[model samples]
Target chain A: MTGLLAYFVFFATIATIYAIIVMGLNIQWGFTGLFNAGVVGFYAIGAYACAILTGPARDTLIGGFGMPFLVGLAGAALAAALAGLVVALITLRLSEEYLAIATFGIGLTVQLVALNAAGLTGGANGLYGLPRPFWSLFDSVQAFNLFYLVFVVVIGLLVWALLARLVRSPWGRLLRAIREDDVAARSLGKNPVSVRVQSFVIGSAIMGTAGALYTGYVGFISPIDFIPILTFQIWAMLIVGGSGSLLGGVIGSFVIWLIWTGSGTLLSRLAPPDLQAQSSAVQVVLIGLIIVLTILIRPRGLIGEKSAVSSKK
Target chain B: MIQAIADGLSTGAIIALGAMGVTLVMGILRFTNFAHAEYLTWGAYMALAVLSVTGLDAGQTGPFRFGLGLVLATVIAVVLTVALALAIDYLVFRRLRGRVNHITLVFASFGVALIVRYSIHLIFGGAAHYYSNDLQIAWLIGDGLRVMPDQALVFALALLVSVVLFLFLKYSALGLAMRGVAENPALAAINGVHFRKILFWTWAIGGGLAAVSGVFYGMTVQIRPDMGFQLLLPIFAAAILGGIGNVVGALFGGFIVALIEAIALLWIPAGYKIAVPFVVLLLVLWLCPRGLFKGSSGGSK
Candidate 1:
């Protein structure tokens, strides 16, 4: 029973971290109408930044600053925001599909850099020994898991509260105005490009925070963690949860992560031993089908966008 | 350098075919079809299936190292892939045409791409498979440069088909109708061109072209389930680096991008070769958003 509880806590912690990432996506894609197909790229920057800042010395890699966890988190977010600003400034002029493709390319480039830059990223083996916060307070594995879960949940709530407030602010309305009709916003003297870039940077910082949180909990970072499939999974969660709603982002992460893990366990139990290895591939197919089905059945998502000022299409 | 150029040309030929199909869909549909590359994967698998059933893949050939069985399989692949493309359109994309915005359609296509790619993975189990297991030595053309007959055959076929395609677009009645529809759908519809027929024909031609490329690609390299998805970035770069919806431009874009990828290995580590297209894409997008080509033939003819 304790083991099961510990597992749930572990799962919830990861889901909460993903929830933070989803909220970041919501800010960019849902709020500002920026089609950022490179969520994992910014996430990766954050993870690597934090790992490099907070990790212990290693012979092969360039890390070993051994900084405080909070400082590492701040540096990670800053690094990601800087990357977002540069990328957005370069590619934000392209409309819709072009923008998506450009961002996806950026994501791939970042992943490639992480994979091949052995001296900096520790190569494909990944960086390890990143410090976790408040490790001294916990004695047993269960206690540590429970403590981490609370820590992540608190961070998730703080992020949610901040974003919820931001969406209701004037800046949020401007984002929607630009999204619904860019020309109208431009006519009203709003610099849509500047605003869009700002939102992208902020959203990227949030994703970076999530990545830092992930590194804190997992204590390891690898290039594989930043694959395009991670971008797909985040998009799926946001699509399933209402895109424009903060509550939906959190809920969707938990629900989708649950379905993802639950299906894995269920498949392991039901499938014969010969086919157990193939079940993960089946799970990917299932998630993909669910994405299609959700887009078809409920494009607005489960909770739906609860915008007060913006008119519906 | 000559060998690299030869390899680049052969790879570029396959990419040119794929990019042409993508440019077609982007022109007609007004959305980048992310799932278009999966048609190539399906086409390769279709050819593999035909060969396996007929025992033709094992058959021997002459100097070219290709057999009559492979040709028959390619023909069969074209038909099956065209059908698959049409079926997917009828089931998913047709419904999405006027209902949602283009971005929504793009996300839907992303979903479709994932489904198609992973379904192939589930069926094929992720192992790499080749059309011909026989290895042929490259004939020496120079001191260092050698050319494979298969590579020559693939490029020649690609060039021939591209010429035919260009002529068809320039002269044929259906091609004129397609151009009209791409330029202005409402105006084309008013002028007695059936929009649905044009859309169907677009997919048919695109799928058929993709099958040819897929077969050639499988001939050159091993076909894996993820091959289509991995190739997608380069294909997109080719289409965009050439102007979107411009056939001639996409052809040039393919060769340029491939040549760059081949040559970039001298400067960067081989593992970073995957990023060459992306760097080219970012540069092109930043400096020349309209592409290097002068024609912006989309929607205005």
Candidate 2:
């Protein structure tokens, strides 16, 4: 049916957006061994930035530049990269635990700001009517959705190619070297801090791009969309797929998203109407279980790391 | 200003109790237990569950809102929370110990936190619960300042527990073994210290303290599934500010963080109170990475 086709297109488009986010996480966490617990922060920045740039002019709200789609995307990435740079510079020198806590706090702080800063972020209601890329060209909703899906796929491929090239380059090797052992890399005259900063910024920018793409596709943006759970979901995707592998990150995104959406649908149909609200809690529990089981059983994940980055003590 | 200080002390007491477990786990386990906050939630909920079953949540004991029934429920909750912590360790963490990297453990803890928090959410509906609906008059302590008797009780009990814990760690053999392992795991193992025993006791004490804090928090504030999570940042800030491994420092840091948050309300909106701990945490991490305390044998390395 046309309905099924449309749903599939929508699902694939969202999944691809998540894949982009996962790939970004892979760069910071998988490649650089940086525990960025604040994926949502950069993500929120991107979404808000894009919404402000491309959205129609509003008297109450801040920016309504009505920029081109690509310009909005670029602005999102820049904003996210700036945030990533600040976070990395401050917390990268600390222990992994400290970095994790700091990032988590930062993520929460971003959410708080979004909730409070009414004029800028349109408060909790959030900015709506975001201009979708090439939306006006299509007559039907389905046609537009299909067109957007193709556009997203193309962007996804472009990102993949860019990341693939970067990882294969000398700079990518340096990231891996630093990840494996920062001291050894430092001894080899490689400045691990600067390299980590670069990776963090790039990864954050990619997350921003993903956020911008999500805003463009969904046609709305809100603070509620960038909760800590979003970060956790991306983490689950990366961990399940395989951290160090780009293919694994992409696969993990689809797999996890499928399971997440499938569980929701299944739960809605199966559970009684009264208990429907609690079903989300069940889904979260499942996510938590998957994370635990995967870490315990398959630390390397399903696809496993292509490189010989030692996970063992 | 006086009211703010009073509220800060009460909040600090709760944070200190919660941070105690975190700092200990970080010291001995060498990983931040993100799930530790869930213990507080579980503790509060467990107490509520017990009270609801017994229909003992209504009675008020003199000036305080909670009665002997709540106290009994708290004891039961402490035991249950300890069991929960140990069970989690046995099932998940114990298996992953030294097998994976510290970051992996941290991620696992995140998962664990989500599981525990949502499990509480699934069991208890999203609605907030209270131990007693009884109204108590706030005691006028100073000029234009009001302090609740429950706050005083919570502060006293938290201080009492902290002192007892400090003394226990200083004098007790098992506590000494735990400290030894925290300081130098290899050396302690070589010296015939039972690492497993220390780990067991660490969880026991941590869980027990967390339960008390949770109960105290529930007694003062409304009990919600997400209360533990809301408190997580402040607790971490306290622990880090005090120095990660130092128990006394965590206690001190908790009060300092709480006081700052409370006083900052004079300038900033109350909604921004959540950001206060994060700012303190950032400042501490930026300025004093080792924390305000000079020496703590455990996590400083």
Candidate 3:
């Protein structure tokens, strides 16, 4: 029972993390119509920033501020926002599709830099021995996981409330107007560029916050942990949950990760010895299939849009 | 120095062939088809099947040498890749055709990429495969230079194919139609050009070229599921650097990308070779998205 309780808490922590990242994506792609495919880049930056700030001075290449986890989290969020601001300046003027491609390329470049810049990052090996949120107090895995999940959930709910507020505001209305028809949106005295940059930077900062939380929970960070596929996975969770819906994003993350974890465990029994080496790989393929099938059958997702016209469309 | 240039030329040739496939589709379809790399993987498997089924891969140095083996392999892979491209067009892409939004098309391509990559994984067992070749045939040619015959053949083939594609795009009625479709589909249709027909041929021929690049790549490197995927960013970087819909730009971009990947090792770690193309991609996107030469000619004429 305790093992099950610990596992649920771990899973909840992950779901909270995805929800945070997806909220950022939802702002860009779902609300503002800017397809920021480089969500992982910002996420990774946030994690690294937080890790470096609070992490011990020995393993780190720089930023041995040796600050508290809270301070590190704030710094990570700021850095992510700054990075997003830079990327947005380069990409926001382009078409949505072009932005997607550019964002993807930027994400690749970020991952590459993360992998090669061994001094700042730990290189391909990744950074370890990170200080968890309460290193001085919480000792057990379960206690830490429990503490982190509650902390993350509080943060996640706060983000949800903020996003929920933003989309409903006049600013939210303007974003939707742009998504539906950009030319029309521009005709109404709204500067699409500024709004896009704003949404992108803000959402990216949220993703950064998630990254900080994720790093704190895992107590390690690596380049391998931020693959291109991760961008898709978070996107999938948002899609599966229903875009433009904060609650849906959180729910989707839980469902998708559960299936992923469940399949990883179940596949071991059916997989042969030779295939065993590639079992996790096989799970990845299944996830890919899941995304494809889900999109094909239910474009809006399980819960989908509530409106009849939108849902039908 | 001369030998490295020769190898670079060979690598450029292979990349150009892949670029042609990508650029042609991007030109006509009006979306940077991200799944194009999957075609190269298909081509490798196609050639592998032929090599396995009919012991035809082995040959002596004649008119029908590795060159001929390549041509034959090219034919099989191209045909299969074209069909696969069409299947993707019909099954996944065609449905999303009217959606002019790039990311939507990207989503569709991601689906196609997932299906193709995993299908290849299911079939090829995710392990590396190779054409049985051990003959290095490296020779000294004065002033610290070396040449490998296989690399030479691959480059020669790359050159031959690029010229043929240039001519095809230049002279043929089909070529004109393709340019028409690429420049402005609505206007091209107004002139009675069948966009779908041109797209069909483009997908087929593009798949063929991607296959050629794949075969040369497998010959030079190793055949694995991620082989084509690993090349995705570099190929797109080249295509973008070359210009969105320009063939020559794709070729030059491919070479620049190849050069960077080749020489980046001097400064960066050996493991970070892939980063060279990606870095070039970011720089080009950040600095100059219009190809160094020009762009798709606007096909305005």
Using DockQ, give the best candidate's number.
2
Indicate the docking level reached by candidate 1: medium
Measured against the true two-chain complex, the DockQ scores of the candidates, in the order shown, are 0.62, 0.77, 0.40
Candidate 2 C-alpha lDDT tens digits along A59-156: 99888889999999999999999988887888887786888898899899989988888888888899998899898898988998888888989999
- Residue pairs clashing in model 2 are none
Judged by lDDT relative to the true structure, which candidate is superior, 1 or 3? 1
The DockQ value obtained for model 1 is 0.62
lDDT of 1 at B29: 67
Q: Choose 1 or 2, whichever is better by DockQ.
A: 2
Q: What is the lDDT of residue B104 in candidate 3?
A: 65
Give the worst 10-residue stretch by lDDT in candidate 2 chain A: A304-313
Give the whole-model CA lDDT for all candidates, comma-separated.
0.85, 0.89, 0.78
Q: What is every candidate's alpha-carbon RMSD to the true fold?
A: 1.9, 1.6, 2.7
lDDT of 2 by residue, B195-277 (tens): 78888899999999899899989888889989999999999999999887788888888899999999998889877778999
lDDT of 3 by residue, A60-119 (tens): 486556789999889889999998887778767764555666667667777887888888
CAPRI grade of model 3: acceptable
